[model samples]
Target: MKLRTFPQGVFLPHHKEDTAHLAIVRVPPPSRVVLPLSQHTGAPLKPLVQKGDTVKRGQKIADVDAFVAAPLHAPVSGKVAGIEDWAHPTLGRFQAIVIENDGSSEEFRYDPLPEDIESLEPESLRLFVREGGFVGLGGAAFPTHVKLSPPPDKPIDAFILNGAECEPYLTCDHRVMLERAEDMLLGLRIMVRACGAQRAYIGIEDNKKDCITHLTPLVRDLPFPTEVIPLKTKYPQGSEKHLILAILSREVPPGGLPLDVGVVVNNVQTAAALGRMAKEGIPLVERVITLSGDCLKKRGNFEVPLGMLLEDLVALCDGFTTPPRKVVMGGPMTGITQATLAVPVIKGTSGFLFFAQNVGKPEHSCIRCGRCVLHCPMRLLPYLLGRLAEEHLFEEAETNRVLDCVECGSCAYVCPAGIALVHLIKLAKFEVMRRRKRGGK
Candidate 1:
């Protein structure tokens, strides 16, 4: 059977052998959790709970008035120890709310909504999603309520649930697909109703045929027509733009969102989380994450409370088999490397990768093999962007559309010269955005 795919993406070793088959284990919560204020994209939240205040699990502890932001919830019932600077997984250091577990296992439950959530008014559903702190769980962590609220001019026609699990060594979504298929479907239905989509689709990589088989029959339960699309196994296939292209034959214009094309896309885990929230009367306080790499003693997927530190997670795996040369949050393709494990798990974190040795190579001059350009899913001129960045010509890079680069690292992965094309392009993109923010052309 032919599998759907986007053009110009490179295939890589899946590297999911160690944890793909493992069931998600619930990790014990640490005595204290360090909740970062700016875990999601948009405005950073300010503490709602002051130091020494007692809070319950699933209680809203931090929030901001901005429409683009999601509130932070207490993952475990605890007393607010302090709010201070702490190591962040992406940011070097950020303000965090430290909570000391009170050992009561208390919870703050919202009034239960009807099980038939899709029957509610769309506006009501959006408000509930915002209150629940729902965000894209596949890694971007953009507020889900905002995504569901496209302008009237951009009416949403379809909803796509991403289950590609395209990044190497990340199988949290894959496991979620197999184990929580019903919950995912429930969430998908709610989203479709909220977005007033005519139909919904779930896209899974063909490499995981079991997931395709498992979900194909289940989608029949949804009110709107929903199909399980098997995407070709390729790196970055899970990218929102690429997934839309592969499944719907739609190309999102450069810097355009899925909504720009009358479609809304969300991760499978995000949908599942929403389903869980509706069913359990809980807020977003935990997530499933994959832990795997060469240096780890044990590896598998885990259901972890938010704000648990990476150091505590590593210890649960029985510590490293060997001292890690590098530790990365999320996947290797676009994940950030961490200098310390003091960082706590934030909403956007998908997994942690620990490598025994440096996976990087010394930079070399661009060999002009055209491989980076040939394989870039975005179809941008990465080599040209890299050179422009090296020359500190941010404006030139911007003119050439460097901001369109998704930083999937396909250029670096396929580069014969190891030119660090993604890094250079990222720098150029950052500079361009910084300049634009400062009102510079």
Candidate 2:
């Protein structure tokens, strides 16, 4: 297939061979798990259970009064050790519920599955999803219910399932597409009903021909209109904006969203979870995580609980061949580096990558090269944003569309001078957004 052209993007070494072929493995729960109070994008849930309290598997441990946030459940039967501050892999330090495992892999008692799945209403189905604690497993961690509940004024026309696992070194979604085809399709039906859309499309990158081959046949007899488009394999092709453009040829304008174009995008895993939740009433307790890197002895995907630590997960993957110099949660491009291995994996963690000391350092300066601008998918001036940000000209940076940068690090990757353009632009964008929010007050 001929590759589709986007405004700006860079081709980096995928490094996905380390684990892409491996089937998903289940990691044994660690001795203790640190469940963060806040995992989704909205407000943090309040702890419902305190220290010394025993919680059963699938029991609600933390919940928020807000509708925008999903409730959190215990992944295992355990006693709450205490509530304390712990290192969050993405959000830094935050209050977390530490639970010591009781060693019983007990399943929670819930209603048995009904033989007929078509009896439920769309609103009831959405409530079930919210109650089940599901979030976007594709790493944005937005509450799924909120996304389903688009405003009445904005009528949705098409629902897009993002099967584009474009990130390097992570293939959990690919595996899900290949292995969980039925569940994904059923979930799509539910999502179509929830969003009140007439048709749905599954956008998969051409790199995974196997997935396309597997899913195309299964979706043939579906009630709703379903089409699977083989997208051009490119870095950040899985991003919401780019995916919209690739499949539908619609541009999500500056400071706009996929919804603005009457489209709703959901990850395959999220849909699979919804399918399981609607029928089985199971909550989002565990998910598939890709654990791979150069320094690790074992590299593959693992089905792990939300609160497990990196050390325990790495140990299960046969431990590291050499002591890891740095550990990052998720794919290398968009994933954040952890300050310590002790940080627990939250709902958004798609992969845990370990690197040795040989990895290259960040670039020192920009050579005024236009490579960043040329490769940026957003088509914003990353080099100029970096300069404006560095000089503390926050207003100029905003005017130059710093906030529009997706932080995909395309500029940093293409920079011959090794300038940390992405990092500087991100800092400036943050400051600008903060100032704007403050000024509104």
lDDT per model vs. reference = 0.91, 0.84
The digit string of per-residue lDDT tens for model 2 on 39-84 reads: 9999899999999999988888899889889999898898999999
Write model 1 residue lDDT over 352-384, tens digit each, in one string. 999999876776788788998899999898999
Alpha-carbon TM-score of each model against the true structure: 0.98, 0.95
RMSD of 1: 1.0
For residue 337, what is the lDDT in candidate 1?
Answer: 95
Q: Highest lDDT, which number? A: 1
Off by over 4 Å in 1: none
Runs with alpha carbons beyond 4 Å of true place in candidate 2: 1-5, 109-119, 361-364
Minimal lDDT window, size 10, model 1:
110-119
